[model samples]
Target: MSLKTALRVIAWLLLAGLIFVTLSPIDLRPVSPAPVQLERAAALALIGFVFALAYPRHIWLVALVVLGSTVLLELLQLLSPSRHGRLIDVAVKLTGGGIGIAAGWLLWRWRPQR
Candidate 1:
């Protein structure tokens, strides 16, 4: 498969996993007992990184997609008996996403220009 196709597949899979983890009632063991906000931020950062790699030419669009999905998922959490949405979490997610986008952009810029 082509590189673009592979990236797209990875991005989608990451997104699916993100959604499942975020909404699931079961608590998966985290690497550490970090605060929930940190966990959310870290997860989002990875999501943003994958998304940026998947659509490197449209960085702003990727940001919008990431932010939008974050908002949508947070809202959906209200329906989950085990979860509730929080504005702070959204803010942290955005911050983490920004970091991811910046990292991805730097990597993209350093790549050999064909």
Candidate 2:
């Protein structure tokens, strides 16, 4: 597979993992709830870099995917049996995604064009 194809696969896997973490039941007893959740949101945002790199020609799609997935995951959280969804978490996810997009754009700008 080409490098771009590999990156795309990695991006999809990360997205799937994000979905699983958001929707499935997991033990949350060991970590501080707020920080752990925040970290996940931030990491999700950073993961956007993979999409941005894998699809530089589709930056808007990358942004849409990041933001849309974040919203979707937040909505899914409402169905969690042991957890409640919060607006702040949604905001944090958005913030992280937006920052990640900006970071990706900057990186793309600096990368030597093919």
Most accurate candidate by TM-score = 1
* Candidate achieving the largest lDDT: 1
Q: Which ten residues in a row have the lowest lDDT in candidate 1?
A: 24-33
Off by over 4 Å in 2: 28-34
lDDT of 1 by residue, 26-103 (tens): 465245688877887887888888788889999999888887888998899899888888888889988987888777
RMSD (Å) of each candidate, 1 decimal: 2.0, 2.5
lDDT, residue 80, model 1: 87
Model 1 whole-model lDDT (C-alpha atoms): 0.82
Record all residue pairs in model 2 with backbone atoms less than 3 Å apart, i.e. clashing.
none
C-alpha lDDT (0 to 100) for residue 60 of candidate 2: 92
Q: Name the 10 consecutive residues with the lowest summed lDDT in model 2.
A: 25-34
Off by over 4 Å in 1: 26-32
Model 2 error, position 20 (Å): 0.6
Residue-pair clashes, model 1: 0
